[model samples]
Target: MSLVKRIRDISVATLNDKIENAEDPVRFIDKYLQTQKRKLTELEKLYQQTLTHAHSVKQQFMEAESNRIKRENQAEVAVKAGEEQLAKLILLEKMQSEEKSEQYRLLYEDGKQTILELEEQIQNLKDEVQELVDKRAFYEAKIESIRLQKQLNQVNRFIEKQNYYDQSRSIDQKFSELEMQTNALREVRSNDTKTGSSFGGKLQSEVDAQFQQLKKKLEKER
Candidate 1:
């Protein structure tokens, strides 16, 4: 495929979608960047070679034109010396050289145009490479930032959960202590009731004995 076409394809690729779907996004991005760099290098080499070829063709055209002019000068000198046949032969050679020079000149012009286009394409590819490099760095940093934010969120959730657990444990301990205090209070109340009943029964028995003795003393006095 043409280099420009290939670069265009790469430039318009759905890289974000590819990265999102990739199992190893970072690795995928690295590989993709490397491929682009290699393509850029190849395109640069081709551009240089095209420029060199254009220069060579231009030199060829100049040399041919120089030879054609030399031949024309020689033909004029021959005609001045009254050598018509020699002048005719040199004129014919000069025409042939002129034709060759014209052909080379046309080729050189075409080459020059091609070189200009190649240079433009090479510059475009360089710009694309630079843009991609910047994009790669931006994406890498963004991914890292997202990862850090996720980690921070996870840590925050863990801390929240731990605090909840601690509070639950504290509540449970307080409830257990309240339950023990309630039981202790019930036990103390039960003991106090039993002691009061025992004391009241003993006092009633002593009063009954005193009343019986007073009744017997009054009967004896009667």
Candidate 2:
């Protein structure tokens, strides 16, 4: 193979290896399909070349066979005319043509078999590549689904925590308000009792003073 052809083969093989071992199923599958396409393209080129070679070989064999037949006919004619030397030359040429034809035929047969093997290899490679692509898609979808589920779970947990914190803060505020109200009420009651006791003591003192004045006035009039 030429350098360019060799490089192409190596590229395809490397891509195939990467596709086979990729962790991301989606990427692996896509790349695998791409590699298979490339491989098929290369195989197609090889098939065309094989076909051309086979055709050329067949053509050569056909020409050689025709020449051989003509020489044999010429040799028969020469023998009837009693020209032994010419007939001998013709027979020798016929044998050589037959040998060349046989050689071309064998080469053609070999080329044909090689072409068949290459085609079969192409088919098998396509089937295996397709199978791997499908598996990659399936695994990728499964991983995506699991990833989404995990994200949703985290969001739900965060929301629950937020609600819990809000409720806790609300309860604390309400309890603080109730405590203030209770303290206010108690203070009002204490102030009221103190005011009432002071008024009662002042009223009793005024009544006693008035009674003493009346006793002193009565003694003066006597």
Q: How many residue pairs clash in each candidate?
A: 0, 0
lDDT of each: 0.86, 0.85
Q: Return the top candidate by lDDT.
A: 1
- lDDT string, candidate 1, 51-135, tens digits: 7898888888899899899999999999999999999999999999899999999999998888877777777777767766776
TM-scores of the candidates in the order shown: 0.83, 0.68
RMSD, every candidate, angstroms: 3.2, 6.0
Off by over 4 Å in 1: 1-25, 216-222
What is the model-wide C-alpha lDDT for candidate 1?
A: 0.86
- In TM-score terms, candidate 2 sits at 0.68
Over 4 Å off in model 2, which ranges? 1-38, 72-87, 199-222
